[model samples]
Target: MAGTEIFGIEEIKALTDVIERKMIHRYGSHSVRNGIYRVEEFEEKAKKITGSKHALALTNGTAALITALKGLGVGPGDEVITSPFTFIATIEAIVACGAVPVLGEIDETLGLDPVSAEKLITKKTKALVPVHMFGAAADLDPFMEISIIYGIPVVEDACEVVGGTYKGRYLGSIGKCGTWSFDPNKTLTVGEGGLILTDDEDLYFKMDCYHDHGHIHSKAHDRGEEGKFGLGVNYRLSELQGALGIVALDKMDATLEKIRKTKKRIINSVKDTGIKVRPMHDPEGDTASHLIFMLPSPEAAVNFSRAAGEAGTGFSIISQNTWHYAKHWKALEEMGEKDIFGTKAPSYAAETMAATEAMLSRAVMTGLNINMSDGEIERIIRSVKCGAKASL
Candidate 1:
């Protein structure tokens, strides 16, 4: 999961070039820029890789998400349906735009359940953010169908699976707009960066100016002379981050390849002991960041964790993971959106999504590493095998 594990001369060279140039700003310093624009280059590379007609680099993934949401005209009182099993940034982005964040139930893929999402949609539903959780595709077919029928745009959150694809299409490029994170934990780490990809020219231009003080960017005009589109925020990516990102794209393939192969090995080993591995919609397209097992019951999942510990490895149950699971999000409860918005804040109580909760409670998972050694893989395999024998 840590792309930093494979860092070498490429990353160093990128940083050195940025330091030597002394042009840390992304735009308008033409005199010292030396005809080098790493941020633009990074955006070009991102567009080519993701097949997006336009790509905009931003300060972080959260910023990208917010920009995309705002670009679609989501604002006060509007509803955006997303999965409860995603990073908190997804919810925060909606709130940042004064939109109501609606949490939908998840299906087997550990993403938004399409049926539940459709039921939640209304006239105020402006977007359907189907997060590609744990490096696997959500059941996007139904989500996309609902999007087309309801005329709501889908903002695919591919932050967790940077280089992953869905049915041969890149995850971020599949929806109306896709967003990605390039932080240290992602497949392509630039230390801290985010990207937005879209084919809609209007949306692209809107986000571009909105991320940079609402100045309409043009090569012919100087930075200060550019026309203002509207009020905007400084979610701009720096030249240093851009330089890091250019080289980071080159490292993504190797990281993803290693993750896919190693993840398959671990899953195969665990499945042989009759442990049910989480199903994949498009197995070949998965980034394989995580290998999940669905135990027969929550009690069995606890035993499985003990088995993993005994084998000198670690396993996590989402039911207990406060950071990612919505049910445990005390921070959300504390914020008390119910009073701020007209409708009640969406509930995260276990009973509200009983089936999804049951599934989460019976599940244990481990993240795959780009730097996992063969010995480490074997050690995890042995842990599952031995653990299953004692626990199951």
Candidate 2:
């Protein structure tokens, strides 16, 4: 707990030194903007690692989702079914594309419940945005089946998960388009950036052009050196970020191994504490172990968090009710009787009200940082045991 940083500051500083020395090209150059080159390089490495045909880097994770949603033709009147237990960015991206976001309950994996998800689908449903919550991939078999049945595209919100594998296949590679965030908190870090991966040629082209500025000759460069007719923003990563990304990618295997070990330690430590640790459903493959979470009774969870923090254990509430659910409630209720997201209720109003109640009453989330050392895990366990004892 003493000066245990989530990531090595010295490592980042070393990489930054290389950038400052101009050993690496900076982003935003005429030939290859420092940002553009870095983003492109990161995407290339991502493609190679994930086995995807194309990769596009955008400004941030939210922008990446927005780009994918827009590229997939999700617009006004279209609905995208996604789990409510996710970051608002997923919902924001859908809203940005003028699409209605449908709320689906989470299953064991804390991902979209296939059964509940199926109930939400309708003719207006355009895509499925299954978030790999806390680096754990959702059950893709049912998601894939639903996609095939409804003929809708799948855009995976894999921002938190980098190396998560589901059913022997990579999480991002299974969907039509997958977006990843390279924020420092994620499994991988490129300072602050996001990437989109896909095998679909058309979708790739649209996203590629959209990230750059609406118009850029594939082989050469943009027609207008000064400006362009197409549309795009400065959603690019610096070459420096890319170089750091390369270094980070090299350590992915080691990072994941360490994460798994830590997760096991934490899970085992809490086994007899009576606190129900959430299970990561990886029936097909391995989870990235981004954040180990638990959904204990709200009151107990609060007390546990307080005790842990006092004991020098870092405890975080990853999912705070805040203002996200209200927007989701309104969006879902506005869907009318189309049933774009599965619910027993006949209209969006009924479903939203019910979902709102469920989310408010329960929904506890905690995280285990990948860099957590054994001592930290022990401290956390001791705190949880103490809390459990108090409850008894």
Candidate 3:
């Protein structure tokens, strides 16, 4: 919802200017290849913003995840532990890398439970991918400790929590490597783009090469020049997308501030509704992009959601959403005894996430967008109040 609409008129002008510059300079479509200025500029800005040593722009968030996994050497026989309550992209990335995805239980935070993740670890556990769902930071300290103890890398899926911070450190910067999405509904949008951020140079280079057909290019050996090629695929972001991303990134702070203020107001509005409502995770020291609350029970959640929808202020029931909910993933059902890697697939399905289900069954959520007018916010508050009263 944050990036659902155009935020500034300058962004359109910037996009047009970049397109004209590309055509005038005869750059063709070599956004990443010809060293188009905006691509590198966006990467540098991203690195600075995320406090990472290196950042790479890619095609989309899913590609970012796959590239991060490939860069970490997670494949075939390796097992990647992640939350079952996240978007399918989290598990799909592990599967794309030929790694067995071990679904871990979530705590009250609605993120991967560090205790459950520790229990899922084995000799084959190569990585832990924790999704920072709905702009809320997961319990990163324990995950960091687990990473140190097991020598396993942590790749954070911070697609929905770009500007959020845990404690003092940024969410994405806390892990070994992290990814952010710039889709239509993210904090920032370049239509369809993704970013990989890391402090590890070796891993960053690997991911860079992996996303760009394995060609390790330099100033001396530019696009057409001789360079060593490794195993990779095409995952480059276009020049137009890079330009849009630059503009979007520039406005990200203001946009997040507005959404956070509006979210606080909405939270305050529902405070005394005599309904049990609590945030899925602690919101202290974080920029919230969504308003997610847990109701008293599953029936209350359903009834509230229905009443809200009728009042024209619908809230998404996390467990019932096909995209974010884990139970609807058809790919997991297709996993047989053994994959192409000869490693047995982890016995993980919707039923395995007992805690996640129990939490989501009573959860009601709505996206917080900066584009929402004050009238819209007021209407949403009124609808929510009405829904709570009707359900009670």
RMSD of each: 1.5, 5.0, 2.6
- Model 1: worst 10 consecutive residues (lDDT sum): 335-344
Candidate 3, residue 257: the lDDT equals: 83
* Alpha carbon lDDT at 74, candidate 2: 78
After TM-score superposition, what is the CA distance of residue 277 in candidate 1 from its true location, in Å? 1.0
Q: Taking the tens digit of each residue's C-alpha lDDT, what string does model 1 give over 1-392?
A: 47778789988888898888788888897765678999999999999888899999999999999999988888888989998888899999988888878888888768789998999988889999999988888988888899899999999998888888888889898889999999888877888999999999999999999999898998767798889999899999998999989888877787788878898888776776898888778888988888788888899999998988888888888788887887777777665446435555665555666767887998888877888889999998998887677667
The C-alpha lDDT values of all candidates are 0.86, 0.68, 0.81
Q: lDDT (0-100) at residue 187 of candidate 1? A: 70
Against the hidden reference, what TM-scores do the models get? 0.96, 0.80, 0.93
- Top-down TM-score ranking: 1, 3, 2
Best by TM-score: 1
Say which prediction, candidate 2 or candidate 3, comes out ahead on lDDT. Answer: 3
TM-score of predicted model 2? Answer: 0.80
Writing each residue's lDDT as its tens digit, candidate 3 over 1-392 gives: 45757556877787888776653221223554445567778888988887889889888999999999999999889999998878888888988998898888887777888999999999999999988887788888899999999999999998777778788667777799999889887878888999888999899889988887787857654477647558799898877888888898888778778878888888898889876655444576456776777778889888888888888888988888787877777767568355647788865566677788998888888777777888999988987888798777
| Model 2 Cα lDDT, one tens digit per residue, 202-304 | 9988776776677553434444553443576656556676666766666677777776777667667777866665565673344435333454455655665
Q: How does model 3 score by TM-score? A: 0.93
